[model samples]
Target chain A: MHEATLAANVLKIVSRAAAGKENRVARITVSVGELAGVMPAALIFAFNALKKETPLDRADLILIKEPVTACCDDCGTDYQPGPFPYHCPACGSRSFRITGGEEVRVKSMELKKEI
Target chain B: MCKTDHNHLEDIDLDCLVQEEDLRHSDRLKAAFRAAGVRGIGLLGSPGSGKTTLLEHLVPELMKKRRVAVIEGDLATDNDARRIQAAGAPAVELNTDGACHLDASMVETAFAELPEPKPELLLIENVGNLVCPVDFPVGEEIRLAVISAAEGEDKPLKYPAAVLRTEGVIITKTDLAPYVRVNPDKMVAYVRDMNPHSRVFLAHMDAAGKLVTEAADGGCSLEDWLLG
Candidate 1:
């Protein structure tokens, strides 16, 4: 999608947490789920381009990419789904719900000092 | 802020989503709609997917029973809003000015711009993009993507987020299906595979710009799903 806009949002989130350049951000770790529909490389590219001389300029972006997992509707077996044609492995049923890989969150941030 | 000495780095428990601000705006907009008794429906798709054309037909039909208003999102044109107005619905146009998607704050402001007494059903036509718009929700009770058969059947599989996030999928332009050799059933199957939760409908616009409901699940029409 528009990772530039999302990058700006990332800065907004980190900026608010950093209290406007007060905190020296060492690293910004975020969870980028596969099913969250965000490309990590694009997000990192935009983030780096935007973070230029800001407080977070030297901050390394650590992305925890989550795999797509689903739970069978009938059997409740959680499994990671592969390319299309997804179905429960145990029951062999197409009736499964996606349980993971849809989250895009900022889990924590590493700072030079305790905030 | 919890400073765990394991890494010698001060860690702060952010514990929040990247879309936190958008979700806040969306939650507020949703609460406002709830208080106003408005069922917000967002129609999204690529440009020329007949979103406005479908509204041109459905607006009048919906207004016959309840008050209906439309908010049109486009890059630089009020043409869609004007068309919706011609169809007898008070319309507001939101030009994103080259932005890919309409955020909740923009939609919240547009909702406030509609006519007084408030519409029972508010239709929001998002900017013509399949990827970004699905992620940026506009406080719609139901969101549906309009994919024309002219674009072929590969869209649902190519863009899984659109099918997964939206509650319904509408395939338009079935009249030109044979000409394009793109089977609409295959499109429906792919949509079902990606998201079995989506309600699928087949639609086509006539030469007069009238929307023809070519196929729909029994008693599960878009009208029934939204208005009910």
Candidate 2:
């Protein structure tokens, strides 16, 4: 699945960040948008499956799901439109643009520093 | 004293480190296209939603005006590529070989195979599944999603990501509405409700092969909305 590619990217990022550093990855936290089209479960499965034979094998994956939000263009109102029929509650305008919930990024990570 | 006890944990803020790199496959693909001066449109839809058929008509018409190249994404088959070629434009088929969607890396490889003189218009017909394709940006300047009347009016609601993310919606197979018992108006309304910023078009080719398309709220044809 496409999540495999995403997981691979995440591993690559973690590896590059830890390179030359005397540390071991303890955890990797990622934020997945509700509208990002990535299933968090699938990404975790892929991560676990592929993390083997890599430095990330010891890393624990933490997935945070971001909710979808939108801004009404006509009324300049911001609201959380969980899913479609995404109408602006303030003005009842169906015209709005997505403001969030479309990102898939590694937010942060916890590492164990070696003395 | 265990090694685990000797090591202390430190929190590191990645601040989107992966994204910070110019190394993202998708970003690299975008950069290549930008340097090559190639513009692309990504077409997303469900299978049998007339994506190939629509391209069959659109590629030739677009060829008359500007140089057009098509990158066909399918799970397996060069069939779509052949059709686009027959329509008078060079086409490259990128077989996913069972992958549900086409990613930017795939596009990067396909773009290399395109003939010289980088086409002014590059139409990447994404794999037919709407859900997976919505997540991947394959270096397209514009994104279009197609749904047919027979697919039902609730498609936009069911697959909000595909409908909401796209710049435009093309409701194909209008002529089959009566037989399929699908309400074209309701379908348009759902699409509008999901993403008001999207331009909705009701598209169908006449018996004479002339493309007839009407805007959901009326004003321009599909061609005007797409090329304009």
Candidate 3:
């Protein structure tokens, strides 16, 4: 459901950026967070459908998945549970500061132009 | 003595990619909303759950204190916009066409028609469906989900995504309390059990034209998060 929304956002940025350039897009790098609640497969599918007939029609979307991390304010501990949920390892408190995993950004774009 | 080609690689640095990876989406979204100077409040609920009606009643009171801009979303028609205009707030309609939800791009487009944010509150009337709107972020500071007594209390459990995402729940149509068998207390408890941190409010229009709180209503637990 949100995949379409994500695609629309990507398309908007890519289209605007491409408008300033004469050539087509080469690659678009996007950052996807683990807790962003977006499914990468669905986003890719939606992107493929929407990218056609637009400035980003031939652009390749490169998604980099970011890790989720949380910090405990009380105990001053940071936990990186790569394969598990986001609970604090030392205090076991579900209540902690979310330091990462909520980001969705396009880090950079590559363009092909006439030399 | 073997320093290797690390220095040579560093000198060339061809592997380093110099690209225009834009943080501009976040910047654009933030700038567009900042220019609108208006913070968004989302009214969410299922179709025919009296979300629009509740907005129609509540908006005049809110607008009396501050100028309000409304971004009304529907599958089609400018009906909600007309109604909100009638209610005295300048309203713009976003026709999602066949889409089920409103995304950030659509909202950004609406900003072009509205005035710069005048430190006023903007109300976004989401599409009359609960399932899709919850997944999309329209840059709202407060999201309020409406669940009418007529719609059954199990809705919170049934549609936990919307319920869990909101800062508050406004149970509409308290005037129909007598005809309906809804126990407000139980509904509040159920919502709290499901969301654990959402504020619940029972709304009814009073003679003074205010959405009066009734039945087991209190402050939201999520206020801490919202303020943070």
Question: Which candidate number has the best lDDT?
Answer: 1
Q: For model 3, how does the per-residue alpha-carbon lDDT over B15-45 read when each residue is reduced to its tens digit?
A: 1111122223424665666566666677788
Best by TM-score: 1
Q: Give a tens-digit lDDT track for model 2, residues B107-165.
A: 88898899997787889999989888877878887789999998987888888888878
The parts of candidate 3 lying over 4 Å away from their true place are A1-115, B1-36, B115-119, B177-180, B205-211, B214-216, B220-228
Fnat per model, in the order shown: 0.72, 0.82, 0.03
> Each candidate: how many clashes?
0, 0, 4
Q: Per-residue lDDT of B1-228 in model 1, one digit per residue for the tens?
A: 676575566788897788877878887898889888998998999998889889999998888888999999999989999999998999999998999899899988888889897899999999999888987888888899999999887988888888888889999998899999999989988988888667889998679867777435555667767685
Using TM-score as the measure, what is the rank order of every candidate, best first?
1, 2, 3
True lDDT of residue B45, candidate 2: 97
Q: How accurate is candidate 1 locally (lDDT)?
A: 0.85
* lDDT, candidate 3, A1-115, per-residue tens: 6578677778786676557656566677777766555678888898999988876888787788877776765686997654322356798654455566556667666666533
- Misplaced by over 4 Å in model 1 are A20-23, A113-115, B4-7, B206-209
lDDT of each: 0.85, 0.84, 0.68
Winner on lDDT between 2 and 3 is: 2
lDDT of 2: 0.84
Identify the leading candidate in terms of DockQ: 1
